[model samples]
Structure formats: structure tokens, C-alpha cells
Target chain A: MRTLYQFHGGVHPAEHKQESSAHPIVMAPLPTQLIVPLQQHIGQRAKPLVQIGDRVLKGQMIGQADGATSCAVHAPTSGSVSAIEMMPMPHPSSLPDLCISITPDGADEWITRTALDYQNMNPGEVRNRLRDFGLAGLGGAVFPSHVKLNPGKLDKVPTLILNGAECEPWITCDDLLMRERAAEIIAGAKIMQYLLSADAVLIGIEDNKPQAIAAMRAACAATGFEVIAVPTRYPSGGAKQLTKILTGKEPPSGGRSTDIGVQIFNVATAYSVARAVLHGEPMISRIVTVTGNVEQPRNYEVLLGTPVKELVALTGKQRNDTQSYIMGGPMMGFALPTDNVPVIKASNCLIASSPSLFPAPPPALPCIRCTQCAQACPVNLQPQDLYWFSRGREFGKAQEYNLFDCIECGCCDYVCPSHIPLVQYYRFAKSEIWAREREKQQADLARERHEFRLARIEREKKERADKLAAKTQGSKAPAANADIDPKKAAIQAAIERAKLKRSGVTPKNVENLSVETLKEIDEIEARRTQLKQAMEKQSDSPK
Target chain B: MSTALLIMIGLALFLGLVLGYAAIKFKVAESPLVQKIDAILPQTQCGQCGFPGCKPYATAIASGEADINQCPPGGEEGIHKLAELLGVDPKPLNAEHGVPKPKSVAVIDEELCIGCTLCIQACPVDAILGAAKHMHTVIAKECTGCELCIPPCPVDCIQMQVVQEDLTTWKSKYPLHEIRNV
Candidate 1:
């Protein structure tokens, strides 16, 4: 029996998972236009490969991965690239990002793909293929999976845990996926284990997901894999918290799981890897749980660039009282700016938000120094202190208290009796710190460049001075050898040149001129000679 | 009684000698308060604070000869930081010095530039690059957005453009809560 450990404070918010999981997953229809944001993952945004008016087949690479930390973006269906411009993205900030809007040709055709045999291919080759397939963590982080798989420079990976703990309320996409596709998920896990050479693989699912647990257990019965049922709690699915629960090791603050010889992948992510490796298909869609304030709430296999409004329309008619649309689970998800934003890889659930399902939070009251928020904090950080410091804009003090470790899990907000939006304050503080850090970096760069410019100017001045000094020395050397002062030598040379002119050292062509012209020239030379004699006499008379 | 008085005198002299030695051993050579104030001042060196550079302004503030609100580039937040450091009340920015403006960097029109080096001499940070009788251009990265180069340009070719914030530099403010109609 594998032992399960408990993590620090978690709340049991009413699990509203039954309504969404009652039905099997459905395939969402292709929308007329797919608006694919280039930056669907966490790292650098992908660069567009196809231009406007270019024809693209289904699963065609539209945006290529930019750097080591990014993943490729593909067209969800056969389509013509209509516009690749900045459009509204599915971010809480509602800011516009570069997106490729494609008009589907309704053919749903696919490009030729060849899956690599994992057993025959090298690990590096497998990871490269996964990156091209645009695989990312589908557990809401959407971090590129290829970068995570390499575990760069780590000699050994002792344990690989597949996270199936969909602990957030009102999200059952992963649960249904487990129940239906347990064999495929397990196969994906085996591939990951092969890649990492992990000694053991553990699949953790919440106790609330009994069907998923039974299915996963039956599938992994003979595979030497363990499927443990962890107690259902909000945010147990967080990367750190889940690792702590299954492995009894808390990844140190500001560190990664791989640092402790453990690596984790979302179950859905593993499934995608299995597909990409076996079926030669890229990650162009995901299971999105659409529930709340609708006639029939269920999970649907959603395409990457399908808009939220289209997915909501599939469930049922939304109640008129639907207040807003939230993109993920209630615990950690944010309210989407609008329904027009496309669903990217990180989108796991979309709730048709209504008043009863999510009542407006009561007015925030004053902090009474109640330590409840501190108790509920999963990362064991002092929330009240961070709150006060962030509210006062005292970023230094906030950082001193480990503000970045808070993770904005909303647990403090959930437990705060005073109704303080503690998570919001933490987010504000984090963003402020990030902005200030960027400003400091820019300032440092400017300072370096300015100093370099000053140094270059000084060097140029020295070079010019050295050249001028060398030229003067070269000119004076000849005068010094001739036994005359430099200035006197120059004056004597000018006088000799004047005497030559008076002597009429004319060219052959000039001597061939008419006699009248020759007479004029002789008169001019005589005048010049008389003037030179007068200048010399004047100089002799002077004191 | 005489023995007791002699013992007391000897003890007092020994302690005094120890105290004098300790003071000399740990005495600070320079006032760290000046350095702290200097770190807070935006090192624009624009002379908008009526000082030649940020170091002079910091020295004046440390010596209590100048108020902390004199730096316009630092603006209100800067004044607050200065006030906190000096344990003084935060004051509004001194309008006599200058008004706070959006961050800008000097850009020189290369086509219109006559290669005159007046702007180069005027730049406090030496952000402009050019020699006499050569076209001068402003190195945007090095410019502290001081606007000092504008007045000295003979051709009026230098312009200060507000830096546009892209996705990397832009930070979204905290979202306001929407009141439901119900």
C-alpha cells in the first residue's frame, strides 16, 4: 500500500462536480472562424509560420515554437488564414495579443504525420517531437511539456507522479477523461516513465472521483503502476501541494519538483503525449468542462481556437441571470473579460457564471488581526502581513515575508471572515514587484550603455591627439636635420617658391604662345620681382 | 576609606581608556546617510532638482539644505521614499523644480541634423553620439529622458518622445469590482 501524506491547510468547498460528470465527453463542432492566440503557453509566444491568405490543413503548424521554453501552435481544422493581427485574448487583463484568425474550409482535412516509436527513438528525439506537437500541461499552467520532460542535467528521476487530482470545484473534465480513457492515460504514463527512466509511476486521483479511480486502477492493475485516492481538497492539484501529498516531500520554496528528483505531468498532458507519439497527432484540442447555469451541463472535447460563446452554446441555453463567464474552476480561475476570447490550451473549464452559483462577495470589512488567513495558507506564509504590506505598497517588506510563495490560491480569501480579497492584494503585489524588477533591469542596461559611450568618446579623443602629435613630429624632423628652425624653414621654402615664379619657369605650351602674350608675361614677371625686392627691403629696415 | 577611594579612581580611569579605544576602532569614515539618499534619487542628472547631479541633490537632502520633494522624475512615490528614509513628512513635488511627465527618451532627426555637436555637449549622460560636422543621433537606450538635449539643438531636430509600453513593459492595474444590477 502506498502511503499518502497530508499537506498544509485545505478547505472542502462544496464539490459541484456531479452535474458536469454525469454525461460523457462530447466533441464540439468546428466554429466558422478560429482565433488562435500565438501565446497559448507560458513562455515566449510562438512565431507565426503561415501568412494571411495561405491555405492550411487541419493540424498544420501555424505558429512555430520561438525558443527553448515555447511550444508550437497548430490550426485546429483545414482553413484559410484570414487575419493575423492583435486581437483580444483570454486573459484576465483582457489585453490584445497577436492571434491568427482562420476561416475554416469545412473539409477538416489533415496533413501527413508519422509517429515515432518511443522504444526505438532516443529520448531527445521523443522530446523534440512532443515540442513540435505543441504539448503543454493541460492542468491550467500550460507550461511546455518538452522542457519539463528533459530534466536538463539531472542524472536520475526517482519518481514520476501523474496528477489526476482535479480538486477544484465544478471541473470534471479530467475525471471523465480518466474514466473513459484510462488505458490511453496509462500508456502515456508508461511513455513518460520510459523517457525519464523513472523507477516508479504513481497516479493520484481525488477520492471524490470513484469511477475514475476504479477505471484507472483496473487499467494499471498489471502495469506495476499505483493509483491512489487522495482526499478531495481544494487546490491539492497545485503542483507543489500534489507533490507533497503523494511523495511526502515539500519542494523547497522557489524551487522545482525536479530539484528533489521527482517530476509530475497532468494526466491529460500524458494522454496528449501518448496521442502525439502513437497517432502522430498534435495537441490542437482539449477537454473543457462547461457547466453551471445551463440546462445540460457537461464536459466537451474543445478545439484550441474555439471561442467560449460557441462552447457555452453547446451545453444549453444559458440562464438570463448568468452574471459572468469564468474560465477555470471557482477556486483559482479568473473571470474572462468576454465570451469572444478563444479557448487556449490552459483552458480546462468554462462556467456560465450566475448569481446563485457564484454570489457577489460581501463588502470587505477591516482586518481584525484574525489569523484565519494565515492558518488556511497552503504555502505556510503569513497572509495578514503580506496583505498589509501589499496594501501599503511596501513591496520590500512583502518580499521579506515570502510574498511570491503565496501562489494566489484563494484559500486565504476563502477563509477570511472579514471578506478581504486577500488573493487580489497578493496578485497586485506580485505584478507590482515584477514591474519594478523590469524597470530596474532597464535602468541597469541604460547605465552600462551610457558608460560604454563615455569610454568610447574618451578613446576617440586620445586616438586623434596621438595622430596629431605624430604628424607634427614627422614634419619637424626634416627642419631639425636642415639646421633651421621649423617656422624659419617654412618661410624660406615660401620665398624660394616665389623666386621660381619670378624666373618664369613656364610650361612648353605657355612658351609657344604669341609674341604679344609673351611680352605681357615678361612684364608681369618683372613686376613680381620688383615687389619681392621691396618686401625684403622692408623686412631688413624693420627693427 | 582612603583605600576604597584609590580603588574607585583606578577603575574609572581603566573604563574611560577602554571607551576611547572602542570609539576610535569602530568610527565610520563617511556618512552612510548620504549614500542612502543618493540611492533613492533617480539618477537622471537632469538638473531639474536645481542640483548639478543626483549625488549633489542627495548631499543637499542629507544636510537638510534641500527638501525631498524637489525631484520631478521621482514624482510622488519618490518623495514618499525620501520621506520614509529621512523620517520626514511626505510633501507634494515642488512645482518650481518641474512637473512630473511621462517617461520619454530623446530622438534626433538624422536627416535634419547638421552634425553640430551642441546637443552632445548639452547631454548630461552623454547619450548623443556625433562629432563636429557629423550627423548626431541619440542613443535611445542610454537617454535618461531628461529633455536637457532639446534646448541646445541649433536646428530644433531633437524631440522627446514618450516611450510606448508594449506587452513586456505594460502592467495591468488591479481590476475594479463590478456591481451587479440585481
Candidate 2:
């Protein structure tokens, strides 16, 4: 017997598994119209490949995987695409997203599928094949499984933990899956083990479901895989907690299980992988536990994009006392804003809420800081401090206290004597942090572009100034030459007079002058003659 | 006694020299006050704070020539941040400046735009991209939601549109039960 290790803090919520797990899994009838959301998983939204009026077969890829971290979307049944537009999604925010509405042709036709011999094929090829098959973690996170399989840069994965511990109350999709399809799930686990090259495979199912444990143990008996029954604790099924229980290692904060040489996948996800690899069937349906307030509470193999209202109608009529419907487990699930939203890959259970099942939490009172919340925190964080910081909108302090490390399992909220709705506050704080981070990124980009604009404007201004200076210089050169032209003309006239005097040419006007003018001219001539005689005497003396 | 006193004085002088050297050696180069203030202000550069851009406003605040509450884009939160950095009491946003409103980006009606380049020159962030006598378009991501370009639009084709919250930008303000009675 392998000894199990313990985590810091946990709570024991009511299992509530018997309501749905008693019956075998039943295939839900295909709806008339299927509203498949383009963004059913995390990361980038898939791009739609089909247009309205196009025909599609069952399991046909309708939305193509966009980026490395995204997965594709497939048609749940043979159908004709009707409308592809923004429709309300099954989200806590109740926001509208692009969805492809399909009208089934009742033929239930399927596209051609060829099963691959994964053992003989290269591991990378197998992973790529799985990528387009629309396989993701069905364990509420809906993270692309192919991305998780690579374990990037890590040479080896020591252990692969398969989570069958449906710890949250009123959620038994995994339990029912294990009970009914244990052999298939084991086959899927083997495929995953082969892909990861993990040394050991451990399937950790909570002890609350003894039947599931027994079935899984029997299926994995002759195989190297071990089905370990962990203690039934709320959130023991959490990836990190289950890893710790089975392997005695805690994944570091904000790090992945792959960092600790371990990786976890939901049993349903493993089953989907088995189907994708061995049977070449894309993920189009999942076992969803539809219970609470309905006449017939059972697990249904619901097709993706089936309306929640239609699925709830299958479990008999909802009681008059039923107030609302929650999409996942009681602890982690949120109430569906409307029943018109379609079920996606991540939805595991739908609980028809009633007053008795979930009484309205009383008005919140002031915190006395009794530390009960801290004791119940599975992550071992100070819940009271986070609560105070979140309330005061002191995001920096909240972040310093490691607010993002919170798994939001509602352990703190369950134990809070003050009824503070602690998880809601944590969610609020997280959203605010994300919003601010986005804002900061935008501001940084804006700042860069603004600075670039300023530099360009400055360069343009300088260029304009240089061009203007050049033009002015070009115009001023002619004006400067005009001023120099008069000086040149005066110099030219002086040279002409000197040339005329050397030639000894006397004008007729000078000879016809009056007697007084002649006398003046004779006096001038005598002076000029004397000047010439002086110049000649000076030149003769130098010789 | 005199010899002991002289020795103590010499020791004191030696320690003072070491301490002064350490202070100079490990001194941190502080970022200038203007840069720090500029970081807190939203870089809208709308000139609503009576300055050319966020940097000039930051310079004015650092020089004590402008009040901390003058920025409407930063709003009350901006004032609080400035106050915390300057060690002064936070004051409400000055009403003489524009009132705090939802973030908006200017949208140009391309058909109505007569290719006038006035809005491009008026835009402090230069988010508008167009030439004279050509259709101008706003780079939505680069736009700082500053309304500086509205007045310079010759054909009155510019309009300030509030940014709509889509799924990407939407955050659940509160749980449904808390918001609605049901």
C-alpha cells in the first residue's frame, strides 16, 4: 500500500454524489439547433471555418485552432450551419461570443476517420494529430491537452496523475465516467502515459466513490498503472493537492505540475484522448452530471453546444422551488445567467439550484479575524488579509500577499463565519489585477507610439527648416550679385579712361571751347606737362 | 588624559572618512521627480491640464507651478497617486478642468472628412493617420482617448465615441446575486 501525504488545509463538503452516480451514463438526444461557441477553451479563440448554409458532418472541424495554445472546435452532429454570430455564452460574465448555430439533419452522419497506431508513430506526430482533434482538459480548465503533453524542455516526466476525485459537491461526472467506462479510461491513460513517457501512472480517486475506485482498480490491475484511493476531502481533487497526496511533492507557487516532473489530467480527458487516438473521434460530447431539483437526476452524455435548458428538461421537470442552475460543482461553479447558454467542453455538471440545496447566504457582517478562513485555505494563504486588501482596493498589497496563488476553491468562503463571500472578493481582485495589467500594457504601447510621433514631428520640422534655408540662400545669391555689378561697372569705366589717356585722343568738343575755357585748359595742360616731366625725371634717376 | 583624548579624536576622524566613502560608494541614482510624476499621469496629452503634454504637466507639478488635481484624464485616482508620491494630501479633481468621463477615442467620419489635416496636427498623440485631402483614420490602439482633435476638424466629421466593453475587456463587477435581488 502506498502511503499518501497531506496538504496544509482542506474542508469536508457534502459529497452529494449518490444523486447522479447511481444511474449509468445515458446519451442525450441531439438538439434541433446546436450553438457551438468559437471560444470554448482558454487562450485564443478558434477561427470559424464554416459559413452559413454550409453542410457539416458530425465531428467535422468547424473552428480551426488559432495559435499554439488553442484547440479546434467540432460539430456535435451532422448539421447545416444556420447562423454564425455573437450569442450569449456560458460564462460567469454572461458575455456574448461568436457561435456557430447548426440545425441537425437527423442523419447523424460522420466524417471519415482513420485510427492511428500511436505506438508505432513518432510521439510528436501523435501529439499534432491530437491537437486538431479538439482534445482539451475536460477538468473545468479546458486547457489544450496537446500543449500539456509536451512538458517543454523537461526531458522526462516521472509521474502522470489522473484525477478521478470529484471532490466538489453535486459534481460526479468523473465518478460516473470511472464507474461505467473504467476500461476505456485506462486505455486512454495508457495512451497519455506513452505520449508523456512517464515512468509511473497514478489515478487518484476520492474514497467517497468506492464503486468508481473498485472499477478503476480492477481495470488497471494487471497494468503498471496504480489506482490509489485518496481520502475524501473537499478540493483533494485539486491538481496540486492530488499531486501532493500521490507523489509527496507540492508544485511551486505560480508553477506547473510539469515543473515537478508530474502532470495531471481528468479521467474524462484521458477517455477523450483514448477516443481521439484509437478511434479517431474528435471530442464532441462529454458526460455531464445534470442533478438537483429535477425529477430524474442523472449523468447524461451531453453533446457539445447543447442548450442547458434542453438538457435540464431531460431530467424531468424542474421543481417549482428551483431558483437557478449552476454549471459546475457547488464550490467552484457559478450560477448560469440564463438557461439559453450552450454547454461547452469544460462543463462537467449542471445543478438545478433550489432554496434547500443552496440557501441564500445571509448578509455579510464585519470580519472579526478569527482566522477560521486561514485554517480552511487549501493554499495556506492568509485569507483575512487578502479580504481586507481586496475590499480596500489595495491591489498592490493583495498581490504582495500572493493573491494569484488562490485556487478559488471556495474553502475560505465555506469556513468564513462572517459570510463575507470571500471567493467573490478574490475573483474581483483577480479581474481588477488583470484589467490593470492590460491597462499598463496599453499605456506602455501608447507611450512608445507617442514618443515615436514626437521624434518624427521633430525630424520633419528640421527638414522643413533646412529646405527653407536653402531656398532663401538661392534667392539671396542674385541680390548680392546685383550689388556687386555696380562696383564692376565703375572699375570698368576707370580702366576705359586710362586707356583713352594712353591713346592721346582729344575730342572735337575740347578743341572748340571758349577763350576763357581755352585759358583754363592751357593752365591744366601746363600743369599736366609739368607732372609728366616730373614722372620722367624720377624714372631717369632710378636708372 | 591628554594622550587618550588625542587618540579618540583621530579615531573619530578616520571613521568619518570611511562612513562618507561608503555613502558615496553605495548611493542610489534616483529617477528625477519630473519623470516619476509623468509616470503617474495618463499620457493622453489632451492639454486639459493647461500644458502641451503629460511630460510638461509633470514638469509643472514637479516645479510646484501646477496643482496635482489638474488632470481630468487621470481623475481622482491620479491625484491620489501624485499625492502619495509627493507626500502631500490628495485633493479632488479641479472642476475648472473637464469632468472625469468614461474613456473615449475619437472616430473620424471618413466620407464627411474633406481630407483636412487639421485634426492630425491638433492630435497630441498623433493617432490620426492621413494626408491632406485624404481620408483619415484613427489607430484605435494608439489613441489615448484625448479629445484634442475634435475642435480642429474643419468639416465637424470627428466624433468622440465611448469605448464599448466587449468580452475581452469585460470584467464581472460583482456576483450576480449581489447586483440583482434574485
For candidate 1, write residues A1-543 as lDDT tens digits.
778888888788999999999999989998878999999998999999999999999899999999999999999999899999998888886778999999999999999978788899989989988999999999989999988888678855889999999999999999999999999999999989988889989998999999999999999988999999999987799888889999899888788899888999999999999889988899999999998888899999988999888888887776899877898889899899789999999999998888888998987777888889888888999999998998898999999999988878899999988888888888888889998786666556554554565678899999999999988987867854777666787799999999999798765678568999989999999999999999999999969
Q: Among the candidates, what TM-score does chain A have in each?
A: 0.88, 0.86
The best candidate by lDDT is 2
> Which lDDT tens digits does candidate 2 get at residues A355-385?
9989999877778899999998889899999
DockQ of 1: 0.19
Docking class of 2: acceptable
lDDT of 2 at A3: 93
lDDT of 2 by residue, B122-160 (tens): 776778999988899999878888888888787899998
Q: For residues B63-169, write the lDDT of model 1, one tens digit per residue.
A: 99999999998889889999998888999999999999988999999999998899998786778899999999988877889888889888999998998765656
Question: Could you tell me the lDDT of residue B10 within candidate 2?
Answer: 96
The estimated TM-scores of all candidates read: 0.81, 0.85
Going through the candidates in order, the fraction of native interface contacts each one reproduces equals 0.19, 0.44
Chain B TM-score for all candidates, comma-separated: 0.81, 0.79
DockQ for every prediction shown: 0.19, 0.29
